[model samples]
Target chain A: MNDTVLVLSIASAIVAGTPILLAALGEIITERSGVMNLGVEGMMLVGGVVGFWAGVNTGSLTLALFLGGMAGVALALVHAVLAVSLRVDQTVSGLSLVIVGGGLSAFLGSSGDPSLLQSPNGLDVNPLFPQSLRDLPAVGPIVFGHDIVVYLAMLATVGAAYFLYRTPSGLSLRAVGEDPAAADAAGLNVVRIRYLATAVGGLGAGVGGAYLTLAVLGTWQNGVTAGLGWIAVALVILAGWRPGLALLGAYVFGGLRGLSFTLQLAEVDVPSDFLAMIPFVAAFIVVVAVSANPKRARRVAAPAALAQPYSREAR
Target chain B: MSRISVEPRAHGGAHVHLGVPVASLAVALLVGAVILAVAGNSAFEAYRTMFDASLNGWTAFSRTLTLATPLILTGLAAAVAFRMKIYNIGGEGQLYLGAIVSSWLALALPADLPKPLMLLVFLVGGALAGAFWASLAAIPRAYLNADEIITTLMLNFIALSLMNYLIFGSMTFWRDPSRQVPGGKKIPESAQLPALSGRLHAGIIIAIVCAVVLWWVLRQTSWGFQLRTIGDSPAAARYAGMSVSLKVLSVLAISGALAGLAGAIEVSGVTKGLEPRSLATDIGFTGIIVAVIARTNPLGVVPVAVFLAAIATSGTALQGIGIQVEVVFLLQGLIFLSVTAGEFFVTNRVSLSRPASTSASGTSTPGSDTAPVVS
Candidate 1:
């Protein structure tokens, strides 16, 4: 590939990867707190629709993204009520959230300006760096030729890693996930921490969803997030619950997505439809390889209390 | 101080089984009504139309059964796998493979083939294809301890892409080249399932039979006992010398076959061709909802599937009354949520008590398995 093509691919990869990155970062925290929220897709859908609605009405990108995150938080609160408060099965609860979110978003988005479904580009985020910075040498476009969401995603990754590994509350959160009974005994409020983590995770997912409509696709459409939310859930497992690895994994998957377009552009022998399967297939292979070995699987296994609802009385 | 204490119940009585599901349906409708009211639609008017459209007439009920046919099989698939704590969410993909294979067999087999034989071939072919698709994830899960949740989900996407390629992108065997717009070749007339009533086909009978057979196996056979044993406690099953890995492979295969059968039935019963747009809907996911409301019981799956399908069948009618069709999805979600919450009542007994002393906090004997401290 030519240098410009490679640079453009890299930039696009960052853009495609940003949403997944943000969602995964949120999930890492949520999962670290020993709660698995499978409603990321649903959360994202709600986020995207709300964000698009806010952007259309107010014309403020920041408000759109913020409302999107709050929408996700709203869904996550329902999840908390079911999975944490009522102590229902977390997986089932998460699935229901997806259904509710999808239905709610679809209903809400159905009545909006009919023309928005055509994927217009008016809502797109502008690049943070000036054209001069983007026009510099080979590294210029690759590094600085991106929108603000891309930069924020990178910042979020660093923030996630630091919060997870450095902060005292982070340690408490990890402790809760690893051993909720012990965490409870240690005076950590397991329920409260889980609720907070799940909400934070929802916030991230909501922003990721908003980012898709606001920056990536630049329009509101039903099921626009597609399976990116599920991909984020898988990326969390593939990254072994680490923030840095999630960034790497998301970009790699995004790069594969970018390569498909590049290959189609170059008129490769393969069908475009088949090329679209690359990221999913790659995910399957890598996840299988990681989980194939019992030792490795155990090494990178989910937090011990991952999906188990905590009750002091039960212990 | 007053405190609410929750304790796990040893067993749920018969009332819990029958009442919870019925209660959940009512709760879902109530919640759905509230949502409609908030959305500025007349909840009662919309529901009245929904009830009349779905359950008021035999013709209407038949249409609901047509939608319920695939749901029954997929619900059984999910119910079986979920009972063993295996999340085979790829029923969507498995169903697709079933349709692909069954349609292929219909086209390749002799046109002069006997009707019953053709039907059997289609059904069996579809089941095998679904099992094959499921085995892709099942093998890794059984041997490597890979997470089937992710693998199965990934496979769903891959299966979708494969379907798109066959119908839209390539002039493969499944596509009809003669058509201006790309689509699946129509199956021979003899291959179509015989209709029992208005739009309802023999698939309903097949679905009910499978459910009955599954119920019998799970409740009676030694293999079923082993499977249940493994589901409840792997360590106990291991001590009893049961091969958990083998059961995993078989259970998932069985699950896949059921889902695939749904696909085959859909092709033979409704679409009569590999129509991507119609097939790409959320039937598989809806099956999960069916299984959940039924509490993963095979027999319960049938009625639950019908109930949900009734709502779905009325969705178009809902749109006629200025209600979005997505409200059906919203109702389903609400049902799932209420049912999940209702499980706490089934499994746990909660009571309110006041402390003897005037201390701010009420206390119970921690980790005590004794009787409830009623007050």
Candidate 2:
């Protein structure tokens, strides 16, 4: 590829990766606390619609993103009530959340004037750095030239890695995931921690979804996030639950997404449908490879208590 | 402060098992009604219209049955695997592969073949395709301990892409080149399933047969007992010298085969061609709702699939009343939520207990436990 195509690919990769990065980072926190919420897709959809609607009406990006995240929190709360409070099957509960989120979002989105839901001007975030920094050769557009969300995603990744490894609360969260019974015996509130972690994870997913509408696609459509939520879920496992690796994995997958478009621009004959399969196929192959080796898989295995509902009396 | 404590019950009995799903359905409707009212729609009118469209007349009931044909098979797909604690969410993808493969067989087979034999060939071909698709995930999950949930779901997206590619992107055998717009080539008329009623076809018979046979296998056969044992307690199954890996592979294959049957039925009985756009309806996902509501019982899947199919059949009619058809999805989700919460009650009992300190501060010991004995 020429320099222009290369630059375009790199720029697109960062944009595409941001949403997965944010969502995966959130999931890392939830998974670390031993609760697996598979409702990320549903959460993101709700977030995307709410963000798009709020952005259209109020013209405030911050409100849109905040409300989007809160919508996710609402869905996540349902998951918490079922999986954590009611001690039901977490897998089924999470799936229910997706259905509810998808249905609720679609219902709310389709109502009222169709014109009202469609923002004439899609949400946009201007690049943060100055002209000179963005004008530098090769590295300029790739590194310094992105909206505030990109920088925030990178910052969040660092913050997540540090919080997960450095602080006492993070240690408590890991303890709850690894052995909730032991954590409960050690005076930790297992149920409360799980609820908090799940909510936070929802918050991350919501923001990631908002990013999809407000930045990348910049408009609302039914099922707009289009399974990216699931990809983020898989990325968490692929990253071995590390924030830094999640960032790396997200961009690589994002690069694949970007390449699909870039290759088309170069007039390559590959079908778009085939291009779409690359990331999911990659996700499957890597997941299988990681899982096939018991020793390697064990090192990055999911939390021991993941998806297990913890009850103090039962334990 | 009073505290509510929950403990597992030794046995739930027939009432709890049956009552929970029924009550959960009622609760889901109540919630759906409240949401409709909040959204400025008449809940009663919407329900009345839905009831009229799906169940009031023989013709409407036939349509419901037509929709339920695929739901039953897909529901069984999920039910079978879920019974073994295997979350095979790839029913949607498996269903697609079944359609792709079965439709191919239908198009390629000689038109002169006998009707029953032709039908059997394509139907089994579809099931085999689905089983093979499911095995992709099952092998990794069974042998490598990979997470089937992720693998299966990812395969779903890949499968969808492949189907789209066959009809829309490439000049493949599946595509009808004569059509200006992209579409699948229609199957031979001889391969088509005969209509039993309005839009209902012989596919319903196939679906019902599969469900009954699956019920018998799961309930009466030694293989079924072994599978159930593995599901309930894998450690015990292993201790009993059962081949856990082989069972995992076989069980998932069976699950996929059921979903595949649903896809094939949809092709031969309903759409009569590989209509990718129309087929994208969340039948596979809806089947998950059916399986869960049925509590993963193969027999239970039949009635549950019909009930949900009734709601789905009323979608376009509901839209005539200004309510979006997506409300069906909302109701489905609510039902699933309530059912899952209801499951908690089936296995556990919760009771509120007052603190001992309120009545007797000095006489009662502060740290004495008030835990109830379970079982």
**CAPRI tier for the interface of model 2:** medium
Q: What DockQ number belongs to candidate 2? A: 0.71
Q: Name the best candidate (by TM-score).
A: 2
lDDT of 2 by residue, B1-375 (tens): 456655678888889889989999999999999999998999999999999999998999999999999999999999999988999999999999999999999989897889889899989999999999999999999999889999999999999999999999898999999999999999988789999987899988888998999999999988899988998899999999999999999999999998898899899988888989978788888899999999988889999999999999999999899998878878888888889889988888667755555573233242244343221
- The weakest ten consecutive residues by lDDT in model 2 chain A span A113-122
Candidate 1: deviation at residue B101, Å? 0.4
* Global local distance difference test of model 1: 0.88
Q: Which ten-residue region of model 1 chain A has the weakest summed lDDT? A: A111-120
Q: Residues A1-315, candidate 1: write the lDDT tens digits.
A: 225566778777888999899999999999999999999999999999999888876888899999999999999999998888888888888888888888778877775345345436537567899988888786677788888888899999999899988999989999999999999888898989999999999999999999888878788777888789989999999999999999999988788877877665566778877888888899899889888666767787789999998876666
Distance from true location, Cα of B154 in model 1, Å: 0.9
The parts of candidate 2 lying over 4 Å away from their true place are A1-3, A115-117, B1-5, B351-375
Proportion of true inter-chain contacts also present in candidate 1: 0.75
**What TM-score does each prediction get for chain A alone?**
0.95, 0.97
Model 1 chain B: worst 10 consecutive residues (lDDT sum): B366-375
